[model samples]
Each structure stands twice: as structure tokens, then as C-alpha cells.
Target: MPLSRVVNDPEALTITVVADFPVPVERLWNAYADPRQLERFWGPPEYPAKFTRHDLFPGGRSHYVMTGPEGDKAPGFWEVLAVDPGKSFEVRDGFADEAGVENTAMPSMRMVFTFEATEGGSRVTTVTHFGSTEQLEQLLAMGMDEGMRSAIGQIDDVLADLASFAAERATEAHILSDSQVRVTRVVRGSVEQVWRAHHDADLMKRWLLGPDGWTMTVCEIATKVGDTYRYCWEPEGEGEGFGFDGVLLESVPPRRAVTTEHMTGTDYPSTTNQMTLTPVDGGTLLSIVITYPSAEVRDMVLATGMTDGMETSYARLERDVLVGS
Candidate 1:
């Protein structure tokens, strides 16, 4: 399958399986990092896995059981050798009994989980090494290859559930002062993630726009201090639309950004904007403050219900761009 491949090196007493996922590395890594999630796809199609003691660190160990449709159970254990979040991990894989006792009769192997980010998606390489070629051949004869392929195919289901569970929620905005309007939102993901969501064109396009049916057609960004950025929104039909172009006055990723906005096709005057992001309990607390030249100019922009539009765009950005696929 395109998502997974297996290479059997009998002479070297090893087998390597590399799988590609059409999702972010963090999203895909959840399948293994989360114990409950790991249980969902750790077994073959006919046998489902159930994790018991899951300690994910160096020298930690995890025990699990694979239950067949008819109630047959095959237990297993993993002696974690190393761990690198969202990157890779190493473990010693072996068989065990229902009471979590190791089955010394069964062969053991060392397995490594390595993840890499790709242009189209993410790649995870699982390499298993045996003591000798005989051990590798023994497992191959017991349907190891087929079972692994079947188990890897189940990742799609996990990814779909993750996307739905991480769906975005709503946010609110208010007038902070006569010269400034402030919108405070707790965005999903880490501080760095929040920064990238605002800067990356692909991620920004998913939410950085006004109401429904109005689309952001052009988004050009230069995130340096002396650089400029432009965005354009056009209505679906022949109706006239609006957008804002800005030059960066100050820029600090994952922290703050200051800019001056020049609006087009409106009576709205130029405004200075300050956007600050702070790491918070859940995610990143994003504060957007827009300062107009005077109360008259500020009131003029507010009269156009720009605050309502901003609320819509920010809400979408928080929900869809940062967390969603």
C-alpha cells in the first residue's frame, strides 16, 4: 500500500516498515504516543490490542494483549529504550502472558519508531532487528508481514477521529479604548504553532478572511521588520469587497508583531496594529489591538462593524488553521 512498505533483510536479521501519512507529524505521532490510541491499531485486523501499563520513557515498559474475535488473547510487552517526542522512539518487543509475565519461549526483537516531516505529509519508519536470520524467518512464517500491513492500514480511522475531536470553538471581541479595539482569543496549539498559523500562507488561507461567501484571493506576506504583507478578499458575486495591506513596524515570532494598516475602497483611515501572543495554560493567548489615528477614525471603522468581521476571522483561525487539518 502507498501508506506502508516492508523490507525483509534476512541476511541482516531485520525487517523495516516505512509508512507515509497524509497528516502532520504531531498528528500522526499521536497514534503511538497515546496509549489508548496505540491500542486501537497495534494489532492485526482480526485481533485488537489492549494496553495495560504504559510508561513512555527511557527504561519504561508497556504491556498489552491482542484479543481475537473469538476471545483468543496474545499478550506482548515493550521495553522502552529511548523516546523523542514527535520524532522517534526505541523499544524491545517481546511476548508475554495474560498476567504480564514474559514468555521466554518466544523470540524477541528491537524496534525503532522514527518520524520525518515531508512536503506532502509525514513519514514513519519502523525497523525491527532480530538476534539472527532464523528468528526473523520464524516470525515471517507466522504471518508477521501480513499482520503488520493490516494494522498500519488502520491509521486513517485514527486520523479522522483526531481531526474531529480537535475542532475549533468560538471567540469574542470588545472595544478596549477610544483609539483601540482589542480581541483576545486563546488559540489552539503551542506558541510556535500559533505563530506559524498566522504566517504560513496555506494555513492562513484556511481562516484569514471575512464572512461566508467572501474569499481571500491574494495573501502575500513578508514577516521581517521592514517587510510588507497584503491580503485581498472578494465577494462570490459581482458585489464590491474590501481588504487591508500593511507594512511591518515590528516583528517577533511567537511573541509580538506591530504594523500599520492602509485600508482600501472605504472611508476607513490608516490604523496602527499590535498583535501579541503569549503562551497560556491551554494554548497561546493571542491579543490583537488596533489603534486608529483618532476617536473619529476609530469610530468610523467601528461604525462599519469591522469588529464583527474580525471576530469571525479570528474564530476561524483559532479553530481551523491552528488545530484542524
Candidate 2:
């Protein structure tokens, strides 16, 4: 129990919770910046959270769902208002529907999370402001404080497990649901360098080759929304080639991008890929959440050793593109 204090002030229409942890401020900050570690403890023990989208920058938005023991779900959304890197952040937190839209009927609150270095380690103070005294009391009656306490209690375990989320680890994938899978990796480079390596045609050609003998023959890039891009690769000696083409659905330079991908010349179902880059303690955290058409398609793609190929290409990116940059 790292919780040090909890205060509810009806006069100010606010509630504050303070928790301390025996970890560096950077470690504590990364636990929240990376969605993988955040989802581990964002909800109570019985109700584990799954963050489908988490962007910590100002004006960004995050969506998560907590599923109870009996399969009941509670969805929530956060609209980030301000961010000060590892120091603090402010967000408008509220309940949401299954599609992640805000539920206007419920009371929303403004919350500020402040992180600071303490004598022993670090401390995080969270102050939540309600719209009115009635909203404050209503949320209290709904056990909001207790729920927060329970959620913070699990952070210690996540903080201590450093190796599992280390930057040197290979690319890893987590099945978020039957049709959604998130692939994550931390590379030794700045977010800008990594993002450019992905968007620039010359840089991508230098590192996107999956295997040793394969060479990228075509590297067309889509820089803006509604543009389509194509890429093809072939064995250096003599072998059949493969390629993928996609349309850029959304693009936020140096932060996030969304695209729809399918086999180059096939009529197979397409997948929606959402890629997000987050700066962390060690390096840039690259997370790609792919939504397949169905569970069968998701499983089939995994069986094709997708993660292993991605790891190879990312390693090349660090060795050839990022290192020189």
C-alpha cells in the first residue's frame, strides 16, 4: 500500500490522493507513459484494464475498458489538457460508452497528476476537481476513492519488474481481444528519428528489409491522410517477392499514425493499424495496435511469425538508420 493520504474537500469540490513509490521519477513516469505497464495497474485487482488507445501528449486522448470478474465492463476516457513530460499532466477524465465516446450523463472531472522526487524515491499527487459539490459527493458514494486506492496498490509490482519492459528486449505482441493485437518495442533512438525512419522512403528502404537475403525493391511512402503507399521486397539472389499496400487513414507527425493494410495483389481482408510513439526513460516506445477482421485472421497472421520479422527490421533500423542519425 503506497497510498500516503487521501483528502476530500467538499468546500473546494475536489479530492486528492497521494502515493509514494521506491523508484526513480523516470521509472514512475514510464509506468504511466507506456500503455503496456499502465494497463497492468490502472484498474482494481478484480477488474483488469485494457487500454485500446493511450496518448499522453497535450490534446491527446486515451480510452480504456475495465472488465469485472463476471464479465461486466466499465469504459473510461481521458482528454489530456496539459503535459510536462515526467513532471505532471492534467486531463479531463470521464465515463465513456463501448465505442469510447464520452457519456455526457455522467459527471466528468478534471484531474492533475504531479510527479516529484522524494527523499526515499518518488511521489505522485493526484487532485481531481469535480464540477460541483453534488458531483463530488455522488462520485464518493460510488466508491471512487476506494477504486483509486485499489488501483494504485498494484503499481509497486509493475515498477519492480524492469526487465520485462526493458529497451533491449525484442518486439513483443499482446492480444488485446479476439480481433485486436498490440505489438510493442522500445528502440534506442529518439521519437523523431524513429518516426522519420518509418516515413522517409530512403531511410525505410535501408532498414525495413525483414531478412538478411531480402532487399526492398520498392519503397513508396504515404505522408498524408488519404494517400496510398506501396512496398515490395525480393530475395537478392532469385526468389518470389512479396509486398503490402495501404492507405493512410490518419497522420500526426512524430507521434501517431493510422493506416489500412492488405496484401498487395490479393483480395484478402484488410487490417487497421494504429501506431503510436511515446518517449520513455530508455528510448522511444513504439506501439502498434492492429485490428484484424476476425479472430481467425488474427491467429493466422501471428502464426506467420510477424513479430519475429518485425524484430529483425527494428534491429536493422537501430543498426543502420538510427545509429547514424
Candidate 3:
């Protein structure tokens, strides 16, 4: 992928570049809205970015550390000045301490991105202004220009990988019939990793838990067809909250499966689930078609934040298990 065209004026102490992404404006905006997306292109290929703290609100400082091959962390902070969702944002960029606090000792720059629609996609014009010639020299000496170009180069790959997943996230779960609720997410990982993450009890506990406090306490899976499996979840301290047991109707290794689910405590009727995993261009498209007893029961369950929890759980799955894997 080609890096964004760079223009640097040492005399003016400014760097200006406009990048045109083939993806939609939302995709570009999400690179900043989502930390995981931002980190993918936050730095060059050698120095992978890992965000420690990210808050996009005005006056909130987002900090991330880019780790180099030598195991050194080059921390950077963005002091957000303004945010207009899907349109533009401005921030002060500077080096930061290991603790994520900005380092006043180093030179800083004011950076902004103005997003506008275009025939092909959206055009993002990024402008950076330095305080003085010395400050500009300071950044140039640190290869700021080259690093910025390298960082921007990775945006296309990152967005392409997330296009399917982002599309699914933007859409609400569709009620296919009177009894079924379907949710799909295209996650970035090999079929093997995706299969393992979903089937492995220990790995499921790592990211399957919704929010933070709740956890999947018990995970019992029968590997073969016609066998039964059960999963239990409860609050860390509180007593049991919810669980489900299922008998495997069919199994196709990492590709597809059908199961019958029975609720443990809830009055809702049993559910049958068909999990289909189709290998897409980037990864696997995971579709979970779950059938409840009736539309009333499905609606009632959806009202209890099950859809939101599922979205959160899938996001955690992508962030914790997929992506760079």
C-alpha cells in the first residue's frame, strides 16, 4: 500500500498532506473512534502501536505507546482540542512519558484532520504546525515526516480487513422470522484460531465475558456430534446469574455447527442455534442464527440488553483474540 503524499516545509515549520481513502468516511473516522483501529496505523510497521489510554472528548488526552523491535516504547499523546464526529477533529500531538503523561520537555505540534466527501470516497487533509524552527527541526530529526507517512500507509489494509466487521456493527440485529434472532460478525483471524476461540472453554472465558465483571464460570463442550455441552456464567462474587446447556445437533469442524440450547433459570423456551462460518477474503464471516420459542420471547430477551451484550462480547472477541493474531 502506498503512503499518503507528504509535504514538509522546514521554513514554515509545517507538514500538510491530504489522503484519499477508497473506503467510506465512517471507516476513516472509526480509525480514531476505535482504539484498536487507531493502533493499527498509529505508527510504522516496525513499531506496533498499543494504546494505554484513549479518550476522544475535547480536553481529554489519548495516549499510546509504540513498541519498536528493540523492545523500546515510544509513547505519544494526543491532546484533543475539538471533535466533530464523522467530519473533523483537532489535537495537540506530543511525546509522552511511560505513565502516559505528556512530556513538556519535548517539542509538540498542533495537528488536525478535516474530512470531506469526494467522488471516490472521503478526502482527509491533515495539517501539522510546529511552534518554532527549532521545534520543527526537533521533529524532523526524529523522522516525524517519514513516520507519519508510514503510519498513514497502513490505513488501507486495516480498513479493508475491518470492512465486513464494521458493516455488521453498523447494522442492527435483524429478526429473520417469528422465532429467530440473527447476529453476524466478520472477524479477522484464521479459521483455526476462530474455531479454537469459540470452542475452547479456557479461551472463551478470556473474551466471551460481557462488560467486565461477569464471567463464563463453567464451559463444558462435547467435541463430537450428538454429544451435549453446557456453559454457566455468574457474577464474580454474586451467586449464579445465567447459564445454558446444549446438545450438539451437527458438527463440521471449523466450518459449521447446529446445537439445541436450553435455558437454566429463565422461563423462556429452549433455542436452536446454527453457527455458520464461511471463509471470506480477509477472515471468517460468523453468523449465529438463534431461534427462540416465539417473537414475544425474543423481544423480551432483546429488551434485557442481550443484543448490546452480544455486540460487546463480539467486540471483545475481536479485540482480545482476533485482529493481529
- Best candidate per TM-score, number? 2
TM-scores, all candidates, are 0.52, 0.98, 0.54
Per-residue lDDT of model 1, residues 130-187, tens digit only: 9987788899899998998899888778777853324243444445445656555667
| lDDT of residue 194 for candidate 1 | 80
Clashing pairs in 1: none
Worst 10 residues of 3 by lDDT: 163-172
The whole-model lDDT of each prediction reads: 0.76, 0.93, 0.76
Model 3, runs deviating above 4 Å: 2-4, 163-325
For 1-325, candidate 3 gives per-residue lDDT tens digits of: 5345778887877899878888777667766665556778889899988654455656656667788999888888998899886788899988898656778899889998888877887778899999999988888898988888888888888778864355345214656456766666666677678888989888899888877789787899978888988888889886657888878997767766789988876665688887666444445556676778888988898788876777777778878877676
Candidate 1: segments with Cα more than 4 A from true spot: 163-325
Worst 10 residues of 1 by lDDT: 163-172
Write one digit per residue (lDDT tens) for candidate 2, span 1-325. Answer: 7999999898999889999999999999999999999999998899999999898998788989999999999999999999999999999999998668999999999999999999999999999999998899899898898899999999999999999999989999999888999999998899999899998898888999997899999999997899999999999998799999999999888899999998998999999999999999778999999999999999999999999999999999999888867
